[model samples]
Target: MATHLTRRGSIYYLRRRIPLHLTEQYNGKREITRSLGTKSRPEAERLARAISVELDREWQAASEAAAMTAEGKGKPKIDPRYYDLAGAYELAELEEQHAAEVDELHADADRLEKLLAIVERRREQASAGNASKAATISAEARKPRSGAKGNSVSLESVIELWRRDRQPTAKTVDAVTRAVREAGDPDIHAVSRQVVIAMRDKWIEAGNSVATVNKKIGFIRLLLGIAKSRGMIDSNPAEGAELPPPKRAVELRKPYDPEQAEAVMAATAAMQATDPAMYWLPRLARWTGARLNELHQLRVEDVQERDGHPGLLLTNEGEHADGVAMALKNDGSRRWVPLAGPVLGFAMWAKGRTGPLFPAKANKYGNVSDSFSKRYGKLLRNVVKITDKRVTFHSWRHGFADMCRHAGVSAEVRMALMGHAEGGGAAAAYGAGDGLPPAMLIDGIKRINGDSA
Candidate 1:
């Protein structure tokens, strides 16, 4: 049986019919009760449904305790069949739910660990591959032989090397430097044909003559040759580059006839009254078939007058710093050019003592042509119908040589006077002086200047 009471509009229950002493000995002398808070009996009965389940669990626990006590009395005890169906079922279900939650948490941790490992392995492989490729590329780039390594090998370096090793004339060096600086890349091993061709086109567009552009290309070719020899490049790209052929055939500007020569001499003399230096330079060139450079480097000491007989001494100091030694254009140009009569008088009148004979403000031979052209180019062009031609001071040598031929000078004498190499096998074999004697050269000059032999 169970006891029931109503308090605060709620129903309460307590197990009954057991003595207080038995209850204290069997359970713990505490009241076993449950509350069902409701206003009506029906509602209270409905709320007391869970109380019945708690009462059953309490009854079973007490019965188990009494049975264990009886066993301890050393007497055979009867087993009681009792079950707390609600409590047992509810506890079993809670344990199952806890186990399921633990299993799900463990599976999630394992999946995340595997994903992290895969990502780490992929990153390592990618890094190693990139490192290997970088190393290979670096090695290949360094293997090729190039001009003086590092960033310092620049266009300036190329120009400096040309200046030091090629020993080019100042004009030649300046022209080459200008072209190289303007047309080539400093880091590139050799200049490309495309770059050179483009430069050619640009020069032509800028109103430069084909001959001038060709000359510039010639310097670029020389630079490429040096670069190739040094293993800076595998090949010379400019080797196959095309340039415009020289314009105005060489034969068009033929030698002057005797009458034309006389007229030129008269024209030159008449122009002397205004510009003496300009006038005398061409006169001396006509009298002596000397190259423009030879005349520019002529000195007062080189001109010696012995017994009223004048002769020019040609010296070859073999590439001097100062223009003291007379280095001929080639081996054939090493011979002395004899001076006499008007030519001798002209040389003496130009320079009295130890200095350049035909010294211009700029002593270089290249500038002398420019100086002459600026002053008398139009005048000469008006006098002669010299069209579509680039004429320099050296044309006077051709004029003088042609004049000698027309004046009936022998071929041998002409060759000797012009310092040309003799072609005869015997003279070449014996190393005989192929040049004329000083007296004969003086006699030849006199003949050309309208004097008797």
Candidate 2:
């Protein structure tokens, strides 16, 4: 059974035959085969184990489904619904009508028929015991249940449409797109609970944090919701999928202490000549409590003097001006964070800065924050020698909030300065308070920096 692992040109793959009794559940397929997406044997083994566990659970569910069907009939029964393709013409006609030109309409219809043919042939081959031939045709090419709006549409297409309509963060788009690709890019109609569960297991096995796994799953759930709304799927596959509870509250991230902050600032100060982000971003985070991305994505124009005080204006306006799309977490994230004090060095740092205050480059996903996070993490470990796993770059923001509390800043003032949503209440809805007056913010900043007399 260990031979369930195979290699093709240095890439490991999982190849396991369907259990004889379970072939009925797997559309008469004889095996499950998919790339492990890793060249390392140890990593492949871990992923394979995850896949095996999910498959076992899938087989158990299939057995239960089979049992239910058998009890209702004189003999074992395969669901006739899986084989129904009556909506093929209707779906093809829908696609054809969407095509702008006569030539394109014919071409689109032809393409739809070819996809349908592939589905039909896969079923025929599987039923005839030509398992390998059936496997050669993608198992994803199934005839969707007849008479749905988007029965013939691929999940890929649906995802693209959602992206265009919603405009999620680049990181989100990238993560969801990668997750779907890793899951073999099944069509909307083929995305089942089993499929979602299997992908979740694989992510867990790959050592993604609970939060990371949940966030990616959330994307799939959103996509499926869109599918259901558009008649691509009858229901969301991601519903009711549970995950392990998050880390305990005691183990959650804590704000860095004064000593730790001094150490980080001093260490980063040494790199000012070469890596400006290391020197400036920490100070900005400490002073403003702004999220990391907000500080990292700042432009020279964003730094200005408002009401006789220097501050950074965080906004999603002119996003992608630096080749990476910047996102404000919400409308509240767009605020003017006044400089706490001139001693924090923000005034000097912004004096001559032009495009993109930080020099750190965006990765392939059009993000600079991840790069800075990694560099800062390494500094915490190797340079600053702060070994607390819970204390990282974000701790600065936490520390800022804590300082605000100590400074006797009101909840509204603190939340406004930090760009957090004011909780629901009459106070939160007070008129024209979205942009706090500079005099009040400056006073709060002075109190936070312990400069207020």
Candidate 3:
């Protein structure tokens, strides 16, 4: 099959000789050799075939360029593919050396003896056909070599330290770890500007939006910055690497048209008795323009008398009545959203509830609002049949904002009513804690609700 698969010790590796013309581009490396990290011949052959196909394309391109240059009597432009592949290989080789150096710096004679014992045990296990146990020990060997006081560390080791140091959310840790690992998992000290650029290009080529790609790159930057701050590396390779600015107009969420809004309300109203989330969430969002999580995380206690009128308090002040910690998007998100119009009766629905108003929707992370967004999306698609991608559950918030703007509500009152940051100097700061007067809030709410109270 021309897969160029070879056995090195007991592991399978792919070893492909560089074409004669491309050897100079590779800095005189005669062949590209990489471990498949597997012993299964079938799996190794599959991987080797894929790698061979990729290399063949680059080699063919280089040969064609050389032919064209010779005919024209000019120098051929170097293909960036050569440098990207070579850079990955260079970093892979450096990671071994970096790990060894860090180990020497930190390992005492006793520590070295213990490590050698572990290695002996692993090799014995491997020879006895207990490959899984050997593999487990192999991973253990990689981890403790992390030199907390030395100048070099592996990417995985730094990621572990970063997680401990940052105490990032599980979601954040998974995302950052995935991004770094996918970017060739370069040594902490070996990640360069070219490595970051190559990673970005790969994501762009895989059809990620510019925003998504940039977010992933931001994770890499933050991760490498952690290594740099601890003196494990001198600089973050991803510091200045980013894609060109996206040229398309930013797609804003579209507010529902009159028919669409009515359709959603009708669907929700039918199921109000059986599914409270379906019924009340849309109404609340439409009237208050509160963010999805803000409404989802509301406690029954939040639905009470505020300034002698019923309202929903969307603040991260304390825990849920059940003790799940509250989280707000920002301080601006902590304010009173008075009940009015369609949502005026929300307090009645929440009357007997003690903890989360939507307890059934609480995710395992104690974020009581996570599942509602997806459920509402299904309702929009399967039940209401509003299939416009931009017309999501958040569209109710957009519709509420549009309603306020169309009703000639002033910007400051609108900002305060919607829990938006009021940016208007010290004057804006005066009564922020007090929120808009209940009367003013009710007035604006009624105006947007199309009922002049």
Candidate 4:
């Protein structure tokens, strides 16, 4: 009798020759033993001995079975479900064997199909919860009067509508127009998900931060939402689109410290004596933290006393020489910002009754850029020690916000002062509260003036 062994698919096989001496019924179950690996025939014989030992141990345990009538059955009966479980385990074992052979092909079609089914089930479960949360947030955002006005239109159309309706001071209208034009193509209705993703990739390629891309995408989403509401599109493609993850928040620029502050004041004082119009512009900015356009548009009548205290009134509409009426950036932006002592002093010194606070010849908005840089640039450089970070006219507003934070002003008070629309439930319920109570403005003033109290 000769025996042979072979391997196939990680399985071992053995063939045995049966002797012809006995009758076929008593030929002793033609041996077909599986191989355990061995280096030589003696090693193979040793493995065979181990197998014989195991079999004898099993026979000893089953000696009682031979005494029972049930032992006459050829094989034990197996439940159908047991076979099914065994088939599943066998399939799993085969898959593990296949995985070892094809390592890179793990996520094949079958696996993808199973994964998709799980994902869809999870999404269905989450849909209702997400919708409810969105509705709650939208409802709260609509509570304030400013919020209502703000909601009537989107931020995309704010400048266009402002220019059309409000005859804003020429400088203001121009500035807003530039901002709008720079934001170009407000109709992002045709922007696809792939387009947005590409745009984000391009931004990253250009070395922009994820936060920067997110900010632009946020504005893009706002535009798309507005376009949908206005019937410009049937759907907002930006909705449900994944945005790039934001980076850590950066610290905001703060107000100049005392020595730096003195340099700015000294520069303004010197400029006041030399170039009065240019000097008063930055002075009012530092004093009021007003937007550049706001300072540029000031008229004599806009500065007045309310209840024996000086206040500045702002309107969306600016009068041309011909007296045409127009709306401001939005209805919410038409509210007044109170003027403190420094702002009033700067206004009085300028002494303009019916024209711009820093009046320029027609079509000369950009002309003041050089004059502005010359006056405050050096002083800001000396103070901040970084020429790039030197105070711009816009920095006044940023600096004022920083001062407010340093003074421990409440978020509500600071937001109201900055003309930000309230979206919180409590803020919306209370409304604007008759124009940011004078005390808060006074407190803001004291902080800027370096008053300890």
Candidate 5:
């Protein structure tokens, strides 16, 4: 039979009347009905075709049940609970279809008269344990999640709350906001697992890396988990989204040789007359082995004494002049990096300022490492003629690490100084020296400096 659409209130439903021949054997029900769950007529029409296919499958099941009845061949006694459930779905379908009609089904009649309770319990049973496992096995599973779908918060509101409370980077907050807005901005509860899978596919098609795609998906999952914790969504849509296999690590950038390093340091001297931020940032990175953002975000106050020797404090806890927030990449990234001999000279050059030492290079996110990065890129490529893309500003940090390695510094000492994460096992937990001594860091730098000279 051809499927048809009918509206009860604003929601469209899929309905197909049972043929005369089947009505007598099919529990005397004259029509098959299910909520299309959407008001859009076009979407409802497309969904009607799927419900019609479901109705065909139900007809096959009913035919088998009827044959068993006719031959008296199947299980002799059927459980009343089974038919009771069908009655529940049937009654709810009836009520939604006839909402304008009488409201006199007495509460004393039966507990299942609460049709919503039965439907909800059935949904819970379907989703309890193995179903979650099944969802993991498949690329996508879209079904009625276990929660009250009646009340839902908007996806945009959830993102705003997450950003405010979670305090991710401005760049990170922007990326997540853009990605969610791109994913159609449905209510948080309405975002099914299939939607998350589709987003993964869309990002892959647009040429994002496996790492980037996974990170974006991770952000979505993390946000949904927050929503779930607050009872806004029943489940996280991004829980089992697939990711590409891990990519092989590539070493794309290398530090300058002694001659190249000496030339770059000399160029910074000429630049100091025009722009001290440009001059000092690269020079500090050369000696201290700090990330560009770490150096760029430093306040004058960050340069202070460590064990009677000058050191640069790299941390997220500083009280900036404008009070813009800051964060380190990880916990280990917060430490006091001792200034070497060359850096002590720059420290004396940069003392007595209460604000950022590189205020001119600062931007809205609190660090304009990009400004310095671009400026240095030109110097390295156009002027110094080191055409390799790998040997940019970051290469100076690499140059320091290489110096540490060539000086036979211990792995743990290098890691601690660089603010890398604690290494694996009991070693990371138990082997606690407060930090590397200033003299060691100085020694590592002096060897490199002497070589360049």
Candidate 6:
């Protein structure tokens, strides 16, 4: 066998011993082992067999090249008319290098056939005394010719364009830039499949989650795609280089129960009494089902009347007052959530505030949502003492939806109130109406409060 399949815990790897002669040339390297990127033994074996064949071809070509390079070996006979013995020797060495390159790249058979035909023609010239033709070919091979412009796509340029255009948070963009830099920031087109796979493996070895590593791969593809579209590179090397699915399943956040909901409200009220305006965030998120940062980053003017009804508006419009430019998570996130019940007091309090309603938390992460998420999770775990790991701040959104469903709120009203995407036939219902009135949204909010209203 050219190579063997080895199991590392559950996953399989392809392992091949390096040839003895080339081992020294590789600085004492002994084996080449690669993860087959599969957990199924059968699939791993199938992938292994194909890769093993490629490795054998590579090693055979290397061995032949090494033998030809041996001192006083494979000497060519001189025939001055057709070709000089010196030129034949040089051509032999070049052919050896070309063969090894073809094996390494797994180039098409037709390309290898073309290289062989060139070698045969050179040999015929040496035998039949075609010195001028042989010399011309050799000289041309040595001359420098302009190739494609892929190499000009610089690492710095891709990074700049991605940061400027994509507008990811500082934490996200900086992490992506750091990963690319750690990968040595190769030219965009030069990031071959092998290089990208190795980079992903490095992340896995460093204990990064599969999801996080996948996002990194996405960033690499996105950055390189930008360069390719502008003709800077031949293609995006990172395209289609996705890793296998993770072993673990994704866990969804669970909803807060009624007692737990009451505890949260009590916490908010305590904070509100001493809370001033700071305590209003929970109430606003509860009443409107708006995101934590959506409420946290609100300006005084965000309080507006839509369709002649008073409500709090959630918009992707950035920089409430020439502040940091913030965008919504997606198009579905931008909508007007009606404000009512306890949230009315909070809106009245912010009627004329010039700056952000919660400036302190908003400025911390350049991502107030992220900062609030951590603090809220800690509040639930440490203070509120809710031990359910599945529940988090995101669960409040689910709780609102649950309340709307239990209260028999029309699907259209529920989707409109929570900014959820209306799907299928239900979308027409929303369009058929002028808009959801604040009174209807208040009824739903009151249902969430268990008729305390």
lDDT for every model? Answer: 0.55, 0.70, 0.69, 0.50, 0.66, 0.64
Question: For candidate 6, lDDT tens digit of each residue in 67-156?
Answer: 678635766553665446446644655565456445534643776588569756655655332344333333432333234363345454
TM for candidate 4 is: 0.47
Model 1: per-residue Cα lDDT at residue 191: 39
lDDT of 5 by residue, 1-453 (tens): 223677654455677667544788668998776766443455566788877778779888887777678677645665778677667766666665454222212322454366447645654675434344334423332334456366656565777677555546556766776666445455666678776877777667657888788888887787788888887766787886859566674566898888888888777777775887778888788777888887877887878775576777787663343434344654457767767677678778768566777664345455547687788789888877888777878888898888788867666667766777666422442111246676655454555556323
Flag the better candidate by lDDT, 3 or 5.
3
**lDDT: which candidate is best?**
2
Clashing pairs in 5: none
Candidate 5 regions exceeding 4 Å error are 1-143, 146-150, 153-155, 187-193, 207-211, 227-263, 317-332, 352-355, 423-453
Per-residue lDDT tens digits for candidate 2, residues 1-453, read 243566554445777666666787678997787776444355567778899889889988888887888888877555765445335533544454344235444765997799669756654654433443233223533534334453356666667777656656545666777666545566667666766776677667657877778777777787888988876567887876758665664646789898998888788777777888888888888888888988888888888777888888887655434334455765556788788774446766778767777756666555568788998899899988989799988888899989999999887788888877657432442212346787888889999878887
lDDT tens digits, residue span 28-108, model 4: 654445554321233334555566566546545454544354457655665788767657755654564455435424534
Error of 4 at 158 (Å): 15
Q: Candidate 2 regions off by >4 Å?
A: 1-150, 205-209, 231-234, 246-252, 269-275, 319-332, 342-344, 352-356, 369-371, 421-434, 451-453
lDDT accuracy of residue 286 in candidate 6: 63
TM-score of 3: 0.57
lDDT of 1 by residue, 61-128 (tens): 77788778878987663344223544554465456545644664686599769855874565466555
Lowest-lDDT window of 10 residues in candidate 1? 1-10
Rank candidates by lDDT, best first.
2, 3, 5, 6, 1, 4
Q: Candidate 4: lDDT over CA atoms? A: 0.50
Provide the RMSD of all predictions against the true structure, rounded to 1 decimal: 47.3, 23.7, 27.3, 34.1, 26.1, 28.1
Total clashing pairs for each candidate = 0, 0, 0, 6, 0, 4
Looking at model 2, residue 144 earns an lDDT score of 46
lDDT of model number 1: 0.55
**TM-scores of all predicted structures:** 0.50, 0.59, 0.57, 0.47, 0.55, 0.54
